[model samples]
Target: MSDSNTTDFTNPSTFILLGIPGLEAVHVWISIPFSVIYAIAVLGNLTILFIVKLEPSLHEPMYYFLCMLAITDLVLSTSTLPKILSIFWFNSREIDFNACLTQVYFIQCFAAIESGILAAMALDRYVAICHPLRHSTILTKPLVAKIGLAVLLRNGIVVMPYPFLLMRWSYCRTNIIPEPYCVHIAVVKLACSDTRVNSYYGLFVLFFVLGLDVIFIAISYMQILRAIFILPTKDARLKTFLTCGSHLCAIVIFYIPSVIYSLIYRFGQNFPQHVHVLLGNMHFLLPPMLNPIIYGMKTKQIRGRLLGLVTR
Candidate 1:
């Protein structure tokens, strides 16, 4: 073990990522599944973007949100997965201090942006279902543009301080990070200086951005369900419910792991270190890999276009 007193107290030139703690021996084996998932996520999200762009009928509010989501997922995963694979494959774990901070920013920013998009999608569905006649008017091109911009700006501003705050801290502790990726909390925990502000701000971002989005999505879906049930015809109700099926799956895959990971990180002191690390990684990995698959299978228009592309 290296002595902390001997190390430079200021932000070190690089931080070492341990990549799944106790699973060092089988990192190569672990990389196999992660590599496969990353590939599918890349291909699936690219396909969604391509098909949506090609299909003029998909030029609607919902698909626009989906496009934004695809772009966000691409950035979110790309920010961390390449570095993680480097650690798993080559035992290359040293991340430059600046690069680590950049990774931390993108990972958190895109995640919050994703949550915002989901809320916007839920509102879109609510309008489309409960107020079908005004759906087009309510979710016009300009309005959708504004919503996207607002999501970007909100998350960007919220996460922008992480790097700056981190830079101000003194990392007198060991530079080794037990997880494959650099997150705000994980990086901040290394600081020997007072980190109460970092912790409190992280909690604020969690609840303010992600928490509010989840609540909004839930309320929108409740309204959507109520509207669907009142439609009187079974076929109409089923069709309307199916319209929300994909987004609901996206929400589940995205938020469930995230909540679980956050809980484990904060409270699960008795749990193995790998559990926390795995959950954190899963929070990032599962949504990107599963979202396109969910939307592709559930959204008929995209599915049809995908089929047409494959057949052609």
Candidate 2:
């Protein structure tokens, strides 16, 4: 249990991730369900990405966002599921500190990218529906590229500190992460040294980065609603609302669970770890799996074109 008692890091060159402690007894049983979900998640996202790439007509802004979403989902799910499945099937959950941090880094990056993409998509909807006359001029290809680059840079800077802070902390003592994967906060929490800085940074991210993005999304939707009501033609209003409906649903499904999990983990106590694990998997999987469906089902042009391409 002490720092010196555990095997030396230099010799072993790996640390065991004591995954889902109480449930380790049922690793085999867990594998059955976990494998199924993992397979479906990866396959589902890949299909979306394939359809987006093959369909030439989906080269526009909206489908581009959907493609990006699929890519992000694949990264996000890959970050954790392989390790999780290892624990389930092979009973091997060892992950070196460096590897663990690397996983966390990528997960944070993709999640941040997805958030930025959501905001961009929301803005796209606002323009397409509310500012119909000027939508084309506003969301030009160059502008979209600029927005994507900005999002990547912003998230990179924010998540860059996490791994550095983690490296500074000596975790020779207890290496068992409570959850299945190497979550940023969860990994930091296990450190023997003081984690005040990590906690502070985590708070900053929760409130400032994720919090601000959600707020902006909400405001954008509000403006969208106001614009919708003012449209004189009933058919036009319905069509406009339908266009944004799928995205709106995806946003709620994605953001609400994230916000709720952050709040529950930070403030709420006496909650079960299993609940956290389940929610974490959902958070990683749901957005990617649903995003393609949302965009494909809602967008008439993309759907029709994709179907045509498939048939031809």
Candidate 3:
């Protein structure tokens, strides 16, 4: 560890992660739940992917979108949880500067990708419900591939500048990060140089990428609901709502924590630091852990496939 008085301002070798500032004493205890949740998340997402791949009947636009969601959830969680558990269990807190930047890139990039996937999924539902006759013609294999490519390119291009932006600044302030893993704002704020560009760019990415995704998702759902209400039978309406229930749950689980965390981080100066840390962690953790369970329980095809896999 570099001494406070003698640390190099131009560049630092490593940064120390505090693993949730106020709850340091309970870090080991905290590792238990985090580990359990991470395990479940990994297993659940992998199972979803595996089932979708093996079950020929599951090869459809909707299931392909679900597979994309599962992969995004897996990447998003795996990027942070292992290091978090290491911090808690082994007291391994120091992270190399370049590695920290890489972590930040992956975390932010995949988060944006997940948002895009959700938007795509919403569109899938909208098309399936609102334009059932043209669903196959519209979301064909090539089109789905193109949408996936676009999602990757959009997020990858947007987040690629983060590491370069951070690297340009000198870390004269301090190398102590208050959270378990490297985040864009948390790491950038440590720079002793002017960070307004970084800050503004971060906000732009948030609003431009995630905000637009939310808007598109909301519009898609509105159209879906309108179409549902036009159905003649109550049973048809009930079935349509049930079909969308899992996706609605996933969106709420993914976005609510993220919005709350972003709001508190930017505006709630009086809020406890630990609260911010917990919310940030949950923003990444909860959706991955719960998404599979929600889909498994709500989607009959997945549930049946899971049962067959378990029995066999």
TM-score of each model, paired residue for residue: 0.96, 0.89, 0.97
lDDT of 1 by residue, 137-183 (tens): 99999999999999999999999999999999999877988899898
TM-score of 1: 0.96
lDDT of 3 by residue, 219-312 (tens): 9988988999999999999988888899999999989998889889989999999999999999999999999999999999999999998899
List residue ranges in candidate 2 displaced over 4 A.
1-13, 305-312
What candidate 3 gets wrong by more than 4 Å, as runs, is 2-8
Q: Evaluate candidate 2 by giving its C-alpha RMSD to the native, one decimal.
A: 2.9
| Tens digit per residue, CA lDDT, model 2, 142-184 | 8888877887788888888888888887765566677778888
- After the best TM-score superposition of candidate 2, give how far the Cα of residue 292 lies from its true spot, in angstroms: 2.2
Clashing pairs in model 1, backbone N/Cα/C closer than 3 A: none
Candidate with maximal TM-score: 3
Candidate 1, superposed: residue stretches over 4 Å from native: 1-8
Tell me how far the alpha carbon of residue 52 in candidate 3 is from the true structure, in angstroms, after superposition. 0.5
2 versus 3: better TM-score goes to = 3
Give the Cα lDDT of each candidate.
Answer: 0.91, 0.77, 0.92
- Residue 116 Cα positional deviation in candidate 3, in Å, after optimal superposition: 0.1
lDDT order of candidates, best first?
3, 1, 2
Best by lDDT: 3
**Candidates 1 and 2, the one with greater TM-score:** 1
- By summed lDDT, the worst window of 10 consecutive residues in model 2 runs over 2-11
Judged by TM-score relative to the true structure, which candidate is superior, 1 or 3? 3
